[model samples]
Target: MQEEAYHIPVLLAECLEALQIDPAGTYVDCTFGGGGHSRAILDKLGPDGRLVAFDQDADAAQNLPDDPRVLFVPHNFRHLQRFLRLHKINSVNGVLADLGVSSHQFDEAERGFSIRFDADLDMRMDARSERTAAQLLQTYSEQQLHKLFEQYGEVTNARTLAKTIVTLRATMPMQTIQQFKAAIQGVVKGNPNKYLAQVFQALRIEVNDEMGALKQLLEQLPEVLVQGGRAAIITFHSLEDRLVKQFFKQGSFEPEEDHPFENKKQVSLLKVITKKPIVPTMEEQKRNSRSRSAKLRVAERI
Candidate 1:
């Protein structure tokens, strides 16, 4: 068997601590990339305790634990509630989600997740998925591309970037990372690699519907967690962290509505456990540059 690719867990100690582990309690690792967090949760679990893990990437299935106590669900974390129910689990004691593309996904150049490497324009986290970055570039309207780049990537020149793609794709589709990079040659600012990296990141986010999937995952948190059960979410981008932070605080994407007496009713779903996000230690950041962007937030069921 081929060795399973690995992703170094970010904020390892902090996540283990934030979980406030009950060795006899059941827990869930919603994003089991490389099984790092799942391994930790299992290590802390007693014989009676159970750990269920989920990952959309088929590549991660290799990391699934052989222990009977650890159940691996080969699906997206967005389907948390349904899968938990199917497994006969009504509610869990704790849930942990390490969101965004895994390091292994980026390191494998053929996945086209990293602009630093030349590869196909395929950025689907789940290979079974039909949509690829090139397909999105081929079909998405210029306005749609603009919105995707601006909203997902926070790209400063999204308008021009979108126009550039549409203009270039008219003659030939931007199918490879090299072609796409060449197309955007003029707009690249500061460092070429960094600028292309941001553009590729934007495309990958759009292709995967990452924000949509994240919203779905957040919506199901209230349903999956038992009373007092905590959820630890590790987000690598401001966009993902903002949604997690806001939902934990307000319980929904929409603003809390006022009652008849003009008082806003308290959202009973979750109590934000972390007033501020937990960040990586200086040592971890130095050892792994990927750890620098991670932000971990914890919340508990009310």
Candidate 2:
């Protein structure tokens, strides 16, 4: 199958430019959704250059290119350091991670990522994972649900929604998207579609441990890259972007208040290349709606 057919590469040109690719230098694509960015990186590499791509989703393996230069790792990017060592690579010249769900996952009805679909509430990016959205909804405490919806989804009536879910689940099991939607219909504010999307986003993040994986990936950047190596990450939402921005500036996930001593450190691990994140152009946003929320941040190893 063609790469674009799986998931159109958002901010393709911008990501390639941000990497500052060296034809003979090794690179990594942390989220190889459809091999789109991997293919572009391969096109720029010399015979000796190597590219290691990671994706936890089993469906992604079908789109892998038959190129010896590319090494596709069928695991999450959170294990980046371990995998690189397994390949006998100490450091890479660049790393690119496009975080969040791919268009392919959202379009696939059985994945239950889209609100448009009435499939079972299974949102595990890696099918091997046991937890599903249904399981999360059924198990999480009201307080836990409230925090997830508020923090991850930014849902306006998160507390009320959580309460509603807890009350409804006793009599109505939310095993499918339609059942889950009907359960929360009363608390949905403003636009139903927008509200449901945010709710679904929160559930998906919780089930897949998206934030946890991203934190792990960020923590390993300094160890994974050589001096002057570039890391270009494209985040689809503010939470992910904020973490990337803070890590690039502070070399740690903790807030400046939490790590007051960080300011006095002699050397920082990463130097923020893009002072502000690079956003998609109007034309690009129009062409691909998913690119609208994407913010690309680039950093160089110091």
Candidate 3:
């Protein structure tokens, strides 16, 4: 595996602007991928300012900042609240989270995050994590597989695909990306690239329990942020973006119910700063195509 940083830090400038850095204040970067955003945040902070970065992947520790103002936490961002409290931090000026698999994770073929490369079926972002994609495939029932394929992968033939997996697992355990691909070749409808990518994405998400982790992290944001503190999140998928959007706008995951007898008081702990998400500029897309789908949503604590 490459030891140096591998991620390009999509929409770098936009993220910085959304964060609205305070030179004397403290900040937390929940996803310290390749340290790109962390470095940027540090640049905008003063000598007294502090930056606490968190990355679950042990490999990411190599890129830790050397300055005393920066603190590195080798744990999942889902533990944001517990860790923050440990540092005697009740609130922060800004928080940034660039969610999803980092470029470094995708570049390493052995990590098994991308479909472009032939690698092991292990898709754990944190190598120490117990579950692998293969184990998940082997253990998940047909109905569970169907739900994952349909909800996460958006595969059109989820039912047939799940049924096929159940049949194949009876004879053999799907252990590698190549093996999984080969086993499901019969159900790949059209456009191999698109179909395979979706399947791999679904597996990766499940292996990492990404959505669950993200929800846990988001839930802590309200309590961890001070009044007017900012949280700038960059989500790459519709599901994540929608969750962030809804939370920032309405203060809760579920839609609000109308009450005729009472005035609608805002339950929201955050004020959505971005009426709509900020997308990468065309110039940025040309420079770093990985940023094309990046969506930035900023919110201020209420």
Candidate 4:
């Protein structure tokens, strides 16, 4: 199990440069998949520098580097502040989170994170999670499915797809990948591969509560990092990219409807570093197709 094979860190050099690593500064790798970025951060750190690496998926534990300067926490980055305080740290100099599923999760057939697989409809990033993708199909109402497909997957035929699932699941079993794909075969629109991938992406997002966790992590950034400390986040989809972009630009997930502070002004907490999101180069994308969708945005805590 090589580190690169587990997960090829996307925009590695860009992330390192974004962090602007200081030798004795403390940092956090919110999603320490393969420890790729963390390892690079360590290379620039002096002996006194510390890195707090967090990963909810147990699989990533194996890829963690054996270094005294690194402290591995087996928890989701949503608990970033708690974990940092528990370790007697007040603030970090920089934070990095690559919010993409690792290659290892997709490569393993049993993970159900890939569209190419025919395993159980279980796409839990953290295996300890009780809900599975199959359960969502079995339990979600038609409207719920429609909204999920429409908003999360942006499926053009979301309503029809939801109706189809609601109609079929009563008689047909979609407890596995093969069963689900076959069940929805007739309704697939556009490219078969791309359509199915979108559906799977929606399921994975809901099952793992990824967006919720990300919001929690972002909200903690201002409190956990020192002034001028950088936070570099790499997002894979537009939904995530938009969230990061908005937070960086305005320092809040604003413009929400009927919320308590919908119209209230929020003092900006972050100063945008990258005027535009950084995307992978052609050479990197050619080397790893998965990096194509990645967009890196950075901001400094104000």
Candidate 5:
């Protein structure tokens, strides 16, 4: 896919400003989806500067620029620390992660990320991973599905939806997008499109374990970023935004037992750069409808 059409970097200028690019320092782009943000970061980096970019999607590798200064890692950002050490890098001058699902992924009918298409119910960002949305739906207990829909998707009739899924799975197959949608038709609440979108969002997040991966990345920030270095995260969902906001402001995330870092001294090691998330300008939202929900939060490692 062409970089231009693959994904438009949301809040482009704001993200660059947040990084305060030091031409000779090293940087990290945790989600090198379309390479849009990475390419822009590269423009600000001098020849001696380095950029370590990461993405699990094989499609992303196709967009890698022909530059020796960049070290691209074909893995999820959750493994940020592991890969950084593997490459003999201890700290970075700045870090960025745009946590939005790329337009390319949604537009590609076969990926099953969008509600518009009828395809295999697979929402894996990395094809190498075995879990798929179909597997979750077929296997999860009714209570588990209820919790997923309620917590992740905020589906209005989540409990009912879960019950319906359990009741239907016994007699019908829910192996594809069309099949699942048809199966859940009787219980969809409010707007059909919006309801299905929420349902899909929950499944996608669970199948990929997005929140888990994000927490891992956040926990690594204090260790991987140098003092005064910046972390600019762009989150599309409120839940993801809240996690970043809390981690940047408090250096802690939800669920103490599930915390990614063992060294959680309950003290924040970063300074919040944006008092509130910087949202896309009206002009940008007009140009790209997908960017309307985007929120950019920047913080400096203290």
Candidate 6:
């Protein structure tokens, strides 16, 4: 499949500007979904510049560009530090991570990323992973399901939905998206599409351990980036946006209380560049609806 057809890069110009790329600098595209962002970065680089791109999805490998300047790593960005070291790279001038599902994953029905498709309940970004959405639905306790739905999906009737799944799955195993949707048909609130989307979002997050991976990626940024190096992240939902916002602002995930020694030394490793996240313009949003929810946050290493 063509790269563009796989996934359209969100906030291309904004992300590039945020990175402030230097002609000969080394950069990392932490999530090289379809190589759109990586290609653009490559365009701005001189012959001496290098780009390292990461994607766990095997499908993305076909879209890899044939450029000596670009080193494609078939691994998850969660292990960014380890992979970079293996490549003899200690630090980078900038890093770009576009978080969330790629368009190809959602479009491919068998992946079970989109509620629009009726396929197997398999939502593993890396197909090699053990757990699938079906496995999660079958094994997670009621309380675990409730927490996942409420916290990750923000489903209004999470408790009731979790209970319903627990009761139904006892007799009918939900191995397919259709079966899962049928199981939850009674509890769907508001628009059916919206509700199912939320449920699927929660499952995908858990199956991929996305939040945990994002935390690991964020934690390693300061160490991976050189002084004045930038990190540009595009998040599809508020959960991710909040984490990036907090980390960039305070160098911690949780809010810090004022202390007597607050000003004694610098605690923040990153200085937030975008006071507010940069959203796509009206034109760009119209061009690609998936870009509508994207929030691009840029930060610089202090």
Q: Give RMSD to native, each candidate.
A: 2.0, 1.7, 1.8, 2.3, 3.4, 1.4
Could you give candidate 4's per-residue lDDT for residues 35-102 as a string of tens digits? 88999999999999999999999999998888999999999999999989999999999999999999
- TM-scores of the models, in the order given: 0.95, 0.97, 0.95, 0.96, 0.96, 0.97
lDDT of 5 by residue, 1-302 (tens): 68879999899999999999999999999999999999999999998999999999998999999999999999999999999999999999999999999888999999999989999999999999999999999899999999999989989899999999999998988989999999999998889999999999999999999999999999999999999999999998989999999998888885445457676556789999899999999999999999999999999998
For model 6, residues 1-302, the per-residue Cα lDDT tens digits are 78889999999999999999999999999889888999999999999999999999999889888889999899999999999999999999999999968999999988888888888999999989999999999999999999999999999999999999999998886999999888889999999999999998999999999999999999999999999999999999999999999888888776677688665433789999999999999999999998989999999998
Better of 1 and 2 by lDDT: 2
Tell me the lDDT of model 6 at 179. 91
lDDT of 3 by residue, 1-302 (tens): 33234788877898898888889999999998788889988999999999999999987888876799998889999999899889898889999999957888888888888887888799898888899999898999999999999988898999999999999987865788878888988889999989988888888888889989988888889999888899999999888899899888887777777899988755888899899899999998898778888899999998
Tell me how far candidate 5 lies from the true structure as C-alpha RMSD in angstroms: 3.4
**Candidate 2 residue lDDT tens string, 158-266:** 9999999999999997999999998888889999999999999999989999999999999899999999899999999999999999889988876555355565543
Cα lDDT listed for each candidate = 0.86, 0.92, 0.88, 0.93, 0.94, 0.93
In terms of TM-score, how similar is model 2 to the real structure? 0.97
Candidate 6 worst ten-residue window by lDDT: 257-266
Candidates sorted by TM-score, best first: 6, 2, 4, 5, 3, 1
Candidate 1 yields a Cα-based lDDT of 0.86
In candidate 6, the residue pairs with backbone N, CA or C atoms under 3 Å apart (3 or more residues apart, or in different chains) clash, namely none
| Better by TM-score, candidate 6 or 5 | 6
Ranking by lDDT: 5, 4, 6, 2, 3, 1
Using TM-score as the yardstick, the better of models 1 and 5 is: 5
